[model samples]
Target: YCMSPGIVLTNACDSVRLYGKLSLRRCNMDDDDVQWPFEHEVLLSLTHPAGEAEIHLQVDPWRDFGWYRKPSESNNMSVCYSLRSVDLDELTRDGYVFEDQLRIKCKVVP
Candidate 1:
């Protein structure tokens, strides 16, 4: 599993875009046994309030152009999504954002 501490929201062509980074790390216990260049499909979804539908995004580490391989202790990749991917205003109006906080669900797919 990976975590994105911050997501950058910017205005682009009359719409909004979200940019963030995802990374993989070498765990102390599993580094030796686990394979290098961690390649797993990760699904991230923004949860909606009152059991509404979620906004989903998929990340494939294998397509990151060698950035997925661990050089030192961790490897990183950049990710971005625009209106073509998701609607920000619609999500906000639907209660996806609450108290200035957004809920994101992550799932690792092998």
Candidate 2:
């Protein structure tokens, strides 16, 4: 996960920027069994205090990108999103934030 300060919008200045990126980082352990360049749809969600506040986002893998291909000594990140594109303010207002902590979930569809 990566985070940064609020980003300015060109068209809608009042609109909030994304919370940050949620990425799939490769582990150092050998993953020869796994196929290269993921080709599945990813389901990402933010746990909400109120069930109605839960947010779900779907992302398609960038199979053609080198970052999503085979890994090297340095574990690379593949298939990414902006915390599934949920803004910080929205998350907080929706009860997705608790005690300054946020919970995120991910699922890959083959």
Candidate 3:
């Protein structure tokens, strides 16, 4: 088993485009020894009282990398991603500005 250590947002918590990066770190929490080479897409979903939208991004750190084998037996590892051309501020500022807490959500793409 593994535990998601939450997400680290870049650029002082401001919006990001193709220039920003996000890192997701997970730690080993169970019988699994030497976890590696996992493939999955991460979706960044933005939700508001009015509506919501989801965007998919590559994570092997970024760009759909296959076979990301990180030899970590200690339980510290991370996945990074390059932000797409989406602007968060503009998305939320359409009418109601989202309080920082209700901004975005991170998920493992299914």
TM-score of structure candidate 2: 0.65
**Tens digits of per-residue lDDT for model 2, 1-110:** 12111212122366554433334444644465555425676666676765665576666656667765555544455335533455667667777778987666666667
Q: lDDT for each of the candidates?
A: 0.57, 0.53, 0.44
lDDT of 1 by residue, 87-106 (tens): 56766777887887777777
Return the clash pairs for model 3, or none: 61-80
In model 1, which range of ten residues has the least summed lDDT? 75-84
> Where in model 1 is the C-alpha error above 4 Å?
1-8, 19-21, 35-38, 73-84
Supply the global lDDT for candidate 2. Answer: 0.53
Extract clashing residue pairs from model 1: none
Which parts of model 2 have CA positions greater than 4 angstroms off? 1-12, 19-24, 28-32, 35-37, 50-53, 77-79, 82-84
Clashing pairs in 2: none
lDDT value, residue 100 of candidate 3? 49
Q: Which ranking of candidates, highest TM-score first?
A: 1, 2, 3
Candidate 1 achieves a global lDDT of: 0.57
How do all models score by TM-score? 0.69, 0.65, 0.47
lDDT (Cα, tens digit) per residue for candidate 3, span 18-109: 22234423465442563332445555544564664544444434334431344345343454543454454564565324554444556555
Which candidate order results from sorting by lDDT in descending order? Answer: 1, 2, 3
